[model samples]
Target: MSILITGANRGIGHALSRAWQSSGTEVIQTARNSPGMEPLDVADPSSIKELAERLEGQPISTLVCNAGVSLDKFDELETGYAPELWAESFAVNVTGVFLVIQALLPNLRASRDAGIAPKIAIIASQMGSQNSPAGNRFIYRASKAAAINLGRNLAVDLESDGIAVGIYHPGWVATDMGGDSADLTLDEAVPGLRKQIDELTLSETGCFKSWDGSDCEF
Candidate 1:
């Protein structure tokens, strides 16, 4: 069985992929446009279908849905959050996540048949929490919230299949998306994320947690 990480060309996904590889774990890295990586545009159903067909019988022990966008981070409340932005954000962040999981169910089942309890880790954000401070990035926050909700429901439905789903807030790290002022570095965040995924079990399936494993309120 192997781990599959989406959007692995850059940011936390890149860091996570490298870390796993360095540890000698079999990792399948995918990106939308990166050379030397499996091509996948999570927002594109055809792209997901192609990937599923290619990995036909491979058992995936872990699936990390890390492809996302924060399109309106700087837009003002009134003029921001364009309709197209909402559509694009949800397509990638929410619907895309569900589609990938649905398409890969067979692979996850293969992992189960191999005696592994497969895990799905969704890289949601603390900004998605209803308790989080109100933000200007309305579309991004809402999409992440939806992702968390989707993970929760998937956890419930997949329990009988021995698949665990955990939603996480990858700490705000210094990246193109998180900005240089963000608190944690990739070094600080990726390790904890890996730990969370490693320790996920049916009992912890529906958890919403921070990178450090602190429980998060939805």
Candidate 2:
């Protein structure tokens, strides 16, 4: 099987790439400004088009939209969460995910044509959950909520094409974005995430799940 992962230079993306590689799956790793990998800036339409063109006849069984930014992590409630930060966050976190999937629709169809159910795994966050209330990181939270909504809608739209779309919370791993104090290591999270993707099917499309395979509030 083949997989395409965005932002695979580091964090969970990188870990997932390495894990898939070790299992002998063909993995296409893309990142912004990363050498020896596909140069893709999900926020840039031209870049997404270029990558799509480059991978033109290749079948992508799974597309993991893992590229995201947390620009408002330290923004204060009273004085921060600047307007520009909101734009930047949505540009990459929400819009970028949609753009990549939109550009790669043909490639995903290639997998479906081969009798494989193409899967879209969106790396959303628990922060996006309306059921959970939190403070700070307003921009990140809102963008991720938009991402979840995007995945849900895509699940509906893409189901006829035999594609499954799932939104996932990768858990608070000790990545730069998650901070050193976060629970779960890459080792713990990657396997669970892989399982969630591996088991995703047309029947389960639009499901919001935690890395450990539990359902998450949409």
Candidate 3:
């Protein structure tokens, strides 16, 4: 099957690309500056459109909207919460995911004819949970919350078309974003995620889930 993954140059995205590639799956990788992948600046609509055109005719069974960012200079409760950073995070984590799904709807539609179930996997976060303990990382949390809603809406909207949608927390992976104390390695995380993807059914769409397959509160 052919899959398209964003932010594929590093961390979980990079590991996912490797896992899929090793399994003989065709993977189209995207990142802002990664070599051999589409140069995607998720903040720019023009850039997104350009990447869409580049992959226009390809058969994409899955689209993993894995690109994201966090505020670099702002403290959680600071009055100086950077609008620019919030914008940047939302651009990639929310808008970018939406645009990519919209752009690739046709490719996913075509998968049904090939007897493959089309799917969209959005890498959201547990911090997005409105039901969880909060009071930290405002921008990042908001962005992921938006992503969760996006996936839920897409799951509902795309159900008639037979495309499954999932919003999953990849856990605190040991990526640059996750830091050294993070519990899981990229190897452990991506494979578990892939397994979750493989297990997805129409019944599972619109659900918030964790890497280990537990339901996460929305």
Candidate 4:
């Protein structure tokens, strides 16, 4: 069995891949059309299907849907966010997550049959909080909120099959997405995320948590 992490070429995804690899766990790292790695555009159904076919019947202990985007980061509420930006963000951050899990269900089931409890970890955001202090980046927040809802429902549906699902906020980090002024570094975020993922079990499915293990409101 192995772990599959989407968008593993950089940022939090890359950090999680390294952490698992350092512990001698097999890791399947993906990037969006990147060379020397599995090319996976999470927004593309064809991409998800092809990867699923290729890994068919293989046991996957964990699947991390970490590929996401924040396109309207600098957009102002009055004049900036185009409709297309919302579509693009949802394609990657919301629908993409559901597609990956659907495509990989068989793999997760295989792990369960093999006496391993498989997992699905979604990299959502605290900004998606239902009681969010609204001011900016509504597009990003909406997409993440959808993802959290998806994870929760999926948890209920996949429970009979023994697959656990978790949605988490990977803290503000100094990545290309999270600017240098962010609160936590990748170093701090990845370890906390790892702890959450490693401890995930069927009983704890559908949890909304922060990288530091703090409880988050839906």
Q: Can you give the TM-score per candidate against the true fold?
A: 0.98, 0.98, 0.95, 0.98
Q: Which portions of model 3 show Cα errors greater than 4 Å?
A: 72-76
Candidate 2 has a TM-score of 0.98
User: How much does each candidate deviate from the true structure in C-alpha RMSD?
Assistant: 0.8, 0.7, 1.4, 0.9
Give the worst 10-residue stretch by lDDT in candidate 1: 129-138
Ranking by TM-score: 2, 1, 4, 3
Which ranges of candidate 2 are over 4 A from the true structure? none
Ranking by lDDT: 2, 1, 4, 3
RMSD versus native structure for model 2: 0.7
* Residue-wise C-alpha lDDT for candidate 2, range 1-218, written one tens digit per residue: 79999999999999999999999999999999999899999989899999999999889999999999999877788999889999889999998999999999999999989988899999999999989977778898899999999999999999989999999999999998899999999999999999999899999999999999999997
lDDT scores in order: 0.93, 0.94, 0.87, 0.93
Q: Of the pair 1 and 3, which is ahead by TM-score?
A: 1
Between candidates 1 and 2, the lDDT winner: 2
Put down candidate 4 lDDT per residue, 1-218, tens digits, no spaces.
69999999999999999999999999999888777778889999999999999899999999999999999998987899999999999999999999999999999999889999999999999899897667688999889999999999999999888899999999889999999999999988899999999999988899999998998989
Query: How well does model 4 score by local distance difference test?
Result: 0.93
Ten residues in a row with the worst lDDT in model 4? 128-137
